[model samples]
Target: MNNKKIFAFVIFISLVVASILLLGKDMFSPYVSFEYAQAHPDKYVQVIGRLGNNVPANTEGKGYTFTMTGESDEQMAAWTAEAKPANFEHAEELVVIGKFSREKNIFVADKVLTKCPSKYKKENN
Candidate 1:
């Protein structure tokens, strides 16, 4: 009777709180500089930089390794387990999501996103 109703209300409130907590977690990590990532290797972060001149050889269907220059002109090696993006070479900007590997001294990227140069071109009137 009254006890049963009280138990049901408590259970419903618990479920609502749990759902909010689970959904509140950040979907995308905040962008961090190369220096900060190097210092905090354990935490996952996103790095935004421009593709550097040196491009590591991409083996048969293997991941690609390349250097990226941060906004502060700091260079860091980034490795992605996934295949290189189609517009990687021509990308003006790159956003790498992953954590830094202290042992390897490189950023192990979970995902790579590219912003092509043409995307910023102004249309001729």
Candidate 2:
């Protein structure tokens, strides 16, 4: 092939490689499971799970430590995390960004969001 053809091919391959590298990072991103969180307490993880039941109400004070149950029994694991205030305690879903702590047996979520069922409400109606 001519110099121009070879140059273009190299450029195309470079672009493809760069794109793949960028997208591939997401694939390597750590998935936070209850078991995983327990296994690796220090490594930062992106955890996702259901926000079942309030922290027994009258837990007392702000940001009481709590647990997040995974989706299934197999995935079922618990971690101690400083949850938000009482009003926000009733959150239906939680996505915690933190590391696991085996001794603590808690996720230690740095951030949490309550799933707003209102968002799923039918808008067309």
lDDT of 2 at 28: 55
Candidate 1 weakest lDDT stretch, 10 residues: 53-62
Pairs of residues clashing in candidate 1: none
lDDT of 2 by residue, 22-116 (tens): 87664455666777767777676777776555444224455555555677833333333365544455566666666666665555556655564
List per-prediction Cα lDDT, in the order shown.
0.85, 0.61
Off by over 4 Å in 2: 1-31, 54-62, 74-87, 123-125
After superposition, the stretches of candidate 1 with alpha carbons farther than 4 Å from their true spots are: 1-26, 54-61, 123-125
> In candidate 1, residue 35 scores what lDDT?
92
Candidate 1 per-residue C-alpha lDDT over 1-125 given as tens digits, one digit per residue, 9 for 90 to 100: 69999999999999998887776443446888999999999987888999986665354456878899988788999888798888888888999988899999999999999988775678999
Residue 104 Cα positional deviation in candidate 1, in Å, after optimal superposition:
0.5
**Count of backbone collisions in candidate 2:** 4
lDDT of the structure predicted as candidate 2: 0.61
